[model samples]
Target chain A: MRTVEFETIAEAVADAAIDAGRVLPEDVLAALAAAHDRETAPIAKEILERVIENARIAREHQMPLCQDCGLAVCFVRIGSEVRVAGGGIADAINEGVRRGYERGYLRKSVLNDPLKRMNTDDNTPAVIHFDIVGADELTIGYMAKGGGCENMSRTAMLTPADGRDGVIEFVVKTVRKAGGNPCPPIIVGVGIGGTLERAALLAKRTLLRRLDEHNDDADLAALEAEILDRVNALGIGPQGMGGNTTALGVHVEAFPCHIASLPVAVNIECHSHRTRRIVL
Target chain B: MTDTHILTTPLTDEHVAELRAGDRVLLSGVVYTARDAAHRRMIECLERDEPLPIPIDGQVIYYVGPTPAPPGRVIGSAGPTTSYRMDPYTQRLLALGLKATIGKGRRSQQVVEAMKRHRAVYLAAIGGAAALIASSIKECKVLAYEDLGPEAVRRLVVENFPAIVANDIYGGSVYEETTECSD
Candidate 1:
């Protein structure tokens, strides 16, 4: 059995949070470069160029990639054979979030209540998802999800008869409705075949995957490609100025479902794509 | 590289009138900030028939809640929030002689109608271009609602701030241009 101290987890989370805020993920940067190369519209190209430049400045100066700083969504995969020694895993994570936001000068955007509208100040109570796995290790997947792209994400419960084409249509329509609001060229995460909440979670979790990677299933990969093509065709280019480039990538995650349902969800991520992984 | 145009603010109605959707401008000079909470309070003051804390005649309002400034910096990374979230409150503000609004994304239909009627324009700063945008801000300070932290209404002096006209007084919308081009 392996033992991990609470301070170790807290330290890792704090560092990852700061690093993620300052640096654009390499995969996302490469994806943006690819989009810039193919974009024909001069305005869209300029927008993409500025986006790349923004990332560079953010990295070099240690400034946040965006002012939103985002809500901390932490995915914890804890090894069944490992034991946490110092404190609760969640407490350590919240502590880390506090230190990260405070120490790193990141914005504390989280509010205490939806209706009451009070700022939490430290960005605590991170939305943590835990899973028990076989390896003797702890891996944390972190994303500082901005509100604009998040607000644009959508979900629909399609009948079983709706199937593949229905999914594509819904995804395209959602992107069209989203327009420039999510900050194109956005990454699209699709989740199919699950219960309502599961579908949403699958869509969000799929965003943590590398943008350049594809699903193992050939059919799902093909679906991702098809959806990507259709979404780009919407002509809602970067900042919706009109061009061939709209989405940077489309990632689809799927699961088996009951006979009556075809639940679908689209999680939109802005070009910032601030995600980091910590292993301890 | 596409050409970048420059404009100075507290923008005049004539300046707002000339802007077309998709035209890029680098704005300089005085502007004010207000987000959801500050905007709500401002509107409530109007409803109570009290004077606005800051008179906004022929001025621009940026939709933003900036991160805290680190030691020595005049301000922090300040980027525009999504505009539609403020659409409900915008028309009323425009009626107060506001000439322009700067943010990202499409404005509501009602906001567009108000812009055309009031001779105002909507400009978009790149959504994620906070650090780059912060470079143009020469100064910032809270004018009211200090308790809101980042959401406090701030008076800012910016120099060569970059943006593109997304909505214009001529009833043109950049959002409309994007969808129409695909057809």
Candidate 2:
């Protein structure tokens, strides 16, 4: 059996959190450049420039990109033959999040209770999702999900009769309603088929794809491009101030669903998308 | 925008009048910070017959919940939050003579109407650009509601703080023109 130390995982998580918070991924930067170049409105172009300049300032100063440093979401894929050799997996992950937020000077946005509303102070209890695969590698993926964009996300259950056109229409309408609230030139992550929860999870997982990458499934890739086109045509543009660049990308992930159900979820992400992965 | 306007805060109606939708402005002077939690508290104080800790008349309110300042910093990343959450309280503040408010996103119809009636404007700071926004802030201090932590009301002195006039008194909104939707 392959053995991995809990503290080793913790250390990697800590470093990844801090680095991800400060730096927008390179693919995301390239997408911003393209959006700036492709934009048709003077105001949209100026907004894109400010966004690019903001990234430079955040990196140069070693500061978090936004005040909402985001809730730490860790996706862990463990090998069937591998075993964690130290503390509990959840504890290790939370400890890493606490250390990272503390050391990096990122904001502690988590509260002890959603209703009672007391401060957690250390930004603990990161949301962790685990998947098991038949391999000897343990891969940890981290995403910082800001509430502004998360609040703009939505899910809908459609009849199987609604078909592909329904999926495209719903995503476009949802983004149209979101307007400037989610901070446009946004990335739209779409999950199709599956049950309600799985569709939601898959939508979020699709967001992990690099901005330039297409879906492995050819048909799904075509759907992604079509949805991207329609959403941009809505003219929500950068910051919804109007332009031709409403969405940077649309990522769709689909699986088989029940005959009667077609579940769809749209997880919107802002331009400051930050994600990182470490393999052990 | 073909031109960038430089403005000072505690803004006058005349200053606000010069602004139009899509105009880029560099603001130098003081702005007060308030979010959902603090706005509720200020409204409560008004109901209880208490004077506001900060003035609203001829003032610009920035909707932000800033991170804590690091060892040698005046403020942490202090960018605008989504503004709609504060919409319920906005009309009240506008009625009390708030000159302008800065945030990101579309606003309620009532808010647009109030801005038109009050001769105020709605400005948008780049939403995700917190570190850059903090760089423009020269000073910051908690004015009230420190218990709210990041949501506390704070007074900030900033220079050349960049923003776009998203909604103007002339009934023009950058979002409306962009989205082509009436809401």
Candidate 3:
């Protein structure tokens, strides 16, 4: 087994956290620029310009893009042939998150307990998802997910009869109900076919996909396009100021489920989409 | 289309009266900062019939919890947070003579009604434009609730802070106007 030092992983996670906080992914930036170009409403156009400018300032000055630096969420893929030395992977990740939040000047948003509501201070204990893969290499994907759009995410177990049209309708209605709350123009990640929790996870995972990329499956791609069209037609616009560009992208991920279940989840992401991936 | 207005704090009835939904505003002067935790505490103080930590009359309350400032900066990337969460306490605060609020997203119908009743307004800063927003804040000082960390109440002096009047005293709502036109 090829062993990766624990400190190496910790350092990488720390850098990823800091970088993700400060930088807007290029795909998101391009999508915002395109949205600016396509926008017809003068107010919407102005908002998009500010969004772009904000991203620029965040990068140039090494500043967290938004006041809400968000909870540190890391998705890890570890190969069976690889081993970590020194400490547990989760501990290492938590350490990294702690350092990153402190050193990067990112907001410490995590609370130790949901009900008690006490700040953890260091933004420790990142939400980590681990997967075992066949390759010898390790891959880590990180996202700084703010609370506003996350609060708008939804999951539903639909009857088989609901089908494609029902899914589309549910998504559109959710975005409409969310209105300006999720901070449009938003990116929607739709998870279909998995069990309830799995569907939610899949929906969030789909958000890590680049905005410019489409699902490889033609049918899924078409579904994404349809959802995007209908969501935009809602005219939630930029910051719900009302315009043609409510959503910048819609991505759909599906998995096989029990015959009795047709679960769907929609994960909403705001314009300040911050994410990064690292391979080790 | 409406003209952008340059407004300073301690807003008068005349200042609040002229604002309509969708008007751009360049706001300067002092505003107090509060978020979910701070608002909860403020309401608790009110429940006990204690005075608020900061005076509310004719002042703007920005719904934000800014990140800790880096060295040499007055404040870190400070921007508006979602406003609806504070809806429960908003009308109460407005009833106390709060002139206006600054935040992102739409407020509830009750809050809008309270705005109409109290002759206050709701303004929205660009939701995710934190760094850009910080440039407008010339100074920031924690006024109370220092234990709340980022959620601590702060006194901020801003210059030309950009916002749009999302809701007005006359029941005008930029959100509704945009939606109606889009449809």
Winning model by lDDT: 3
By summed lDDT, the worst window of 10 consecutive residues in model 3 chain A runs over: A169-178
What does the lDDT read for residue A63 in candidate 1? Answer: 87
Best by TM-score: 3
> After superposing candidate 1, which stretches have Cα over 4 Å from the reference?
B1-5, B179-183
lDDT of 1 by residue, A1-280 (tens): 9999999989889998999998998999998898899988888888889989999988988888899999999989999998898899999999999999998899889989999988889988799999999979799999999989999999999998888999998899899988989888899999998799889999999999998899999999999999999989888999877888889899999999989999999999999899998889
Q: Lowest-scoring 10 consecutive residues by lDDT in candidate 3 chain B?
A: B174-183
- Rank by DockQ (best first): 2, 3, 1
lDDT of 1 by residue, B124-152 (tens): 99989898888899999899998888888
What are the per-residue Cα lDDT tens digits for candidate 3 across A83-155?
Answer: 9999988898888888889999999998989999999899877899999998687988888899999998888
Candidate 2 per-residue C-alpha lDDT over B1-183 given as tens digits, one digit per residue, 9 for 90 to 100: 245889998888899889988888999999999988789999999999999989999999999988778899999898999999999999999999999898999999899999999999999999998988999999999989888888889999999999999999999888875453322
Q: Candidate 3: RMSD over Cα atoms?
A: 1.9
Q: What is the lDDT for B33 in model 3? A: 99
As for model 2, its CA RMSD to the true structure in angstroms is 1.7
lDDT of 1 at A41: 87
Retained true contacts (fraction), each candidate: 0.64, 0.65, 0.77
